[model samples]
Target chain A: MVGAGHAGLAMSRCLAVRGIDHVVLERGEVANSWRTERWDSLRLLTPNWQSRLPGFGYEGDDPDGFRDMTQTVAFLQRYAEVISAPVETRTTVTSIRRDDEDYLVTTDRGEWRARSVVLASGACNLANVPKVADALPDGIASVHSFDYRNPDQLPAGGVLVVGASATGTQLGYEIHKSGRPVTLAVGEHIRVPRTYRGRDLMWWMDNAGVHDERWDEMDDINRARRVPSFQLTGTDDGSTLDLNAVTDIGVALVGRFAGLVDGKAQFSGSLLNQCALSDLKMNRLLNSFDEWAAEVGADADVEPSHRLDSTRVPEKPPLTLKLAEAGIGTVLWCTGYRPDLSWLEVDVLDRKGRICHEGGVTSSPGLYLMGMQFLRRRKSALIDGAADDADDLSEHLAAYLDG
Target chain B: MSEATVNNGVNADALVAAREALTEAPQAAQFNWRASCEWKNGTHSHSTVEGFFGLGEEQKRSKTFAFDADHPEIFASEDLGATPVEYVLVGLASCLTAGVAAIAQYRDIQLKSVKATIEGDMDIQGILGIDDEVRNGFDGIKVTYEIDADAGRDDIEALVAQSQKRSAVYDIVTNPTAVTVEVK
Candidate 1:
């Protein structure tokens, strides 16, 4: 198996239950990324009920069922032990080679041969920062959302958040509340309520019934080919931070920072437009909340038809910025991240340097990949929802073994 | 947002040159995702072989396309299951599997079928919700590589490293990105 992470350990558990012989290799300790890399405030967006493998349930105190980052790692560690997963921690694989009728995996620890290999290394290994970020003044400190542990780690001055996605929004709220002047860059963000109609997002997800669903119920494959919009209002743990609380807290709202010309931070674009977009999404989310409320037979807290006064972002220019000129000392890039598959010295990849696979099947006959952001399902990437992907993929692997 | 790419000309060359200069300059300006450490510094940089640069030779992609609500499911939205992240996985898996085929062809190993699968976990509240307390992207992703080759386990595992996909999208994603924010 690949790196023993959330997906990897879960896959190992599924395999163990089925009495399948598989080895899980991890560069760090078991569930190390979840334990070490995630922020202290991190929690599962999906509730406790959603983070289960085929035979395991998140049997904890609260069926409200959301867990913090620590709880998550603890659970995964315990699960790894429960199933006796054959995981080798701190054994980073250097290369994967194919010999006569089998596969050989090289790692720092040692070498191992197997009939198949599972790369459970998920997407977090790569931290994506923009090239332009380096253009800022060195005097000003800048950090990605990954490194942000608390507001204390941030500078005393106000912060400018580049991305308006969930991390951007969450960090913006927390840091702003900490009395730091926080400014959030307006990106196209998908707004979903933490509690829709007084129910958790996971409940709504289950009600949507897309989990363990037929692929066709989703949009057509051709339609699925498009990329996704960035999201802004989901929860990290069971609790979702409400943006409504943000503007009330006096965080400086900003437009996309236009190019920093000659070190003077230039800000263009109508900040008001971003407000309008937020209004639209909030309106939509409110409507969704109302619908959910109706589903659960309850009254809605937010009225769907209510409109509010907001500004529009100027069309002439995206928001522009210069670190020194604007007195902006710190920038937090909430922009998204990509994969780190460079060390993988295999060739099933494409000319464009992407792995070729369909529904988890690589171009190579027996090579496989799992646990990507939305790897197999609309819900596959969520913390609580990953086990579903692991179970499904494990079944497929078992099938191949039987064959 | 509209997608943009500078390719196959002085524009692309200048872009690379400008990106390379970013490593030394510590300003958080634009996002640089190149896999080579010749452009190093950030903890986000590919420092280890597992880091960005150790992946593979760069693949100079010449094209990019934008996606939106109109055609939301193609590379962005998770409508029919697949996502840009999944595409990245496919790209990685595909790269390594192709490497397997290449190695087998080069070594005269018996020709046989090969397949691989990958998976990742991302912070939903961070990526999906409009909250800024969380990070914008995934915390850490896990990839599972499966191989079916006629070669022995050692040979196949070694060849898997030959994949260009690891260096391209995966490496780029793994690197740290910088951006500027303006507050009014």
Candidate 2:
């Protein structure tokens, strides 16, 4: 066990059940990512009912409700206690190397010689701030979504939130609602309704067998994996926050945050296209739902609303808030995240710096990965996906150890 | 930044006098206003509505405003100024904007700009008498605000909430009122 997050703890349980001895190393407390990397008002995109561990599922009062970061953290803490995972907290892994057949995992505390190693911390370790961030002037305070807590932490004045992913949209809406003039830079993303036909869309997706989709079956697995997360929000009522809703809340919509040229933020003029793309995708999904509902005899007759017209704003947003004006005091970067594999001395990284692996089994024998997006199934990277992923990885590891 | 200055687009002097009058003589605050319009052809109407500046005995002849309105093409009329439903939206937006400006001034925050987008969804089935199931009024209304001011998001949200709570039009729309019609 390498991480103490959902992936690590779940893997530990699988190993323990198989009577295999292993110690989980965590850089911080259990579910450290959930504790540190989430915003104040953050809620799981997946409903509480889907927040299931290997042996423990959600047994809370609000199973249909989405769990906020605080509730999620507490759930993980309880899960850790229930599983009794052998975890070493505050031990950061300094290096991991393959010594002949055995793996040498070194941490700040000490080193361990094991027959197999599982990199279970998963992706989303490093904030994927673009190079354009460097061009932004020092006068403006910039913080990635990972470090952002709330609007109160931001400086007064206008805000330019880069990236229209779930995090960006939510933050932009929150900040705009807080009364600051906000300009949200739109980008490519999967658009899905928060709810359809009185049921959470996740519930329907799960039932429709979307998460069980295997990579081999996908026409373009790489492209599918690269598709950004949905423009969905997790709230008590499960209200859908599309680009229209965001714009309706008074946040200025703009194209991709191309870069800061000559000390001004540059934006592309493809906002209308982005909105059209989102609208098309959302309608396709809804039409699919309609077909599914008919086939299943489900009482659902929700007509799709008009596509949110992006051409409404003609005036190209000030190409750049001249840094000299000092009007925009903060530039929030919510441009997603990537994995941090610097500690691994093993030659498993590909050209893109991504770990070279197939279905949790790396090219290097005795090395495996868990909690990776599209490792085997679409759900392979989610909390619910950990059980099966750990089971498969542990089975392979057990066989290798026996061999 | 004088306390008595009309910095927020609200006449501070007039507001102060009204507040004092309302406090001293509560009955003086009770004034009935009306909006009457004669229907032209189709859904067009020419309205010369009464303005709100006048109240009590000191008031001279009521100041009147004129505006022409027509239904949209879908509703079988030329797209004139704004439809009746649109006027409701306009009234709501203006009233809320006023409240925001007043709150901003009261808080001494500099308001640079404020714009509102008010939209109401309606099913034509009700108005067209195609179906009895549908209601006559808008099914739902959404009011979105874009405001630039030297204040925090929370401050602005609070200001908008305050405006909504204090707005008479908002109350009228939200709460049902009693109306009796009789032939004289």
Candidate 3:
């Protein structure tokens, strides 16, 4: 197995339970990304109780609270110890290729040959910055969410955040709180409340079985996998974090970032439509939850169901922003991430660099991918979702070996 | 469910079959529409459309189609026909209207009448070369649809939204496209 993150560690536990031997290769220590990639104030989007592995689950006192970066790293470290996973730390795999009937993994430390390979490296390895970023003026400091640590790292000026998913909304709120004006570029996003009807949204989704929606059951699995993360944040108070929250705190919301045109940043004029679409979808989801609650006779147990206010859109949003005139110095790209699988010398990748897979099974007979968004279920990318996927994939791998 | 093969004057079964066929043979779905225009006078021109390429071969219309385009007298040209920008509005309206009909038929909704009003706002300063900051095209375009259909208000609104979502001309007008121009 490649990587030593939650996915890899969970797969290791599964393999062990199945009496199969495997070594998890990690470039750094266990949970290397949680130790390095996340910002100082970042926390797990899901609640602590949702942090479950194959055989291990969160045993902390604050199950309702979120795990900050430090806590998350410690939790993973404890899981690694408890599972006794054969993790080879500080060994980065340079390439993986088919060697006749076996697979060979070459790393900086050494090499290993196995009959089957599980790619659990993760999905958010590289920030997907657009090509128009190169057109920006050299004086502006551009930072992807991957490399961003805090607001102090940015120069003293207004900032333009180029995506309004979870990362963008969180960082925009943080930087705005740090006394730097922020302009958030909004696009297609999923607006979900952190809590609903006196319970956490995760609790509602868990009870309603939204997370367990199978990939094959979806009408368009590709579209389902490409849906943006919810505009949410994990906070101690469990406060809802959405566009309205950020706007109430004085963050200027603009349309989608079109391009840098003639020294000025161009924005789309579809802000109203985008907000309407998001509002419509949010209401639809809440309605489904309400119907479920009524049908299951759980409405009397929870608070009265209510819908969130529609996103407030400006009557006439500005379509262009002169960076110099607006004193905007930094462009923070929270535009999402893509899996970095350049080292995989396999022929299973599609034209868009996505692995050709049905659920966790790859086109290649003995290869499997883990930890992708909606790999087998809707929650496949979440911390708690690894166990089920690992079990299914490990079963497939074992069966392939047996056959 | 209705057993009829046609709904709202559209052969829904044939449409679905064509969609499935194109999905199987995507190369045949690559259609190229063509039109030829000749300058008639200052700011006035005539265009003809009789042939296109589709289904992996050249195709011809049953009859030759023609159109005349000219600027208004206020723009210092003959008011012979609709302006080019007006033609663009027509394209958007027709495309969206067709999409609404097709989708409504698919959803088993009977339509009585459909009317669309399109307006594009433009600042002439850019086209006149009076201001470099202004843009030559419309700053914004708004389309309003009034449909008398056997559906609720929400259902009608959803139909219009879905039409805009699937309309080819709507996508063309809202997004950027690459075009090349050179002397032969």
Give Cα-based local distance difference scores for all models. 0.61, 0.79, 0.90
Residue A381 alpha-carbon offset, candidate 1, angstroms: 1.2
**Tens-digit lDDT string for candidate 1 (B83-146):** 4455566666666565556545544455455656666666667765667766665544445556
Docking class of 2: incorrect
RMSD to the true structure for each prediction, in A, is 20.5, 24.9, 2.7
Q: Write the per-residue lDDT of candidate 2 for residues B1-184, one digit (tens) a residue.
A: 4565437777756886787777567667777776678888888889987644335644435567888889888856787768888889888899989988887787676788999998988998998899997878877677888988777775676577667656778766654445887766
lDDT of 3 by residue, A302-387 (tens): 99999888899877778789887889999999999998999999899976678989998988889999999999999999988899
- Cα lDDT for residue A310, model 3? 84
| DockQ (0 to 1) for model 3 | 0.33
Tell me the lDDT of model 1 at A218.
56
Q: DockQ for each of the predicted structures, in order?
A: 0.02, 0.01, 0.33
The TM-score obtained by model 3 is 0.92
Query: For each model in turn, which proportion of the native inter-chain contacts is also found?
Result: 0.00, 0.00, 0.00
Q: Which candidate is the best by TM-score?
A: 3
Per-residue lDDT of model 3, residues B132-158, tens digit only: 989999988898999998888766876
Q: Identify the runs in model 3 with alpha carbons over 4 angstroms from their true place.
A: B1-33, B50-60, B73-78, B102-113, B123-135, B148-155, B176-180
Tens-place lDDT per residue, model 2, A1-403, is 6789998888988888888889999999999999988889988888888967888889878888888888888888888899898899999999999898888999999999988888988689899888867777777888899889999999888898888878888999999998788888886666777877677888777877778888779865765777787777888877877666787878887777765766777665445445555555666676666676667866444444333233244344443356437478888998999978899999998766889777889888889899888887898888888888888888998998889
> Pairs clashing in candidate 3?
none
Models sorted by TM-score, best on top: 3, 2, 1
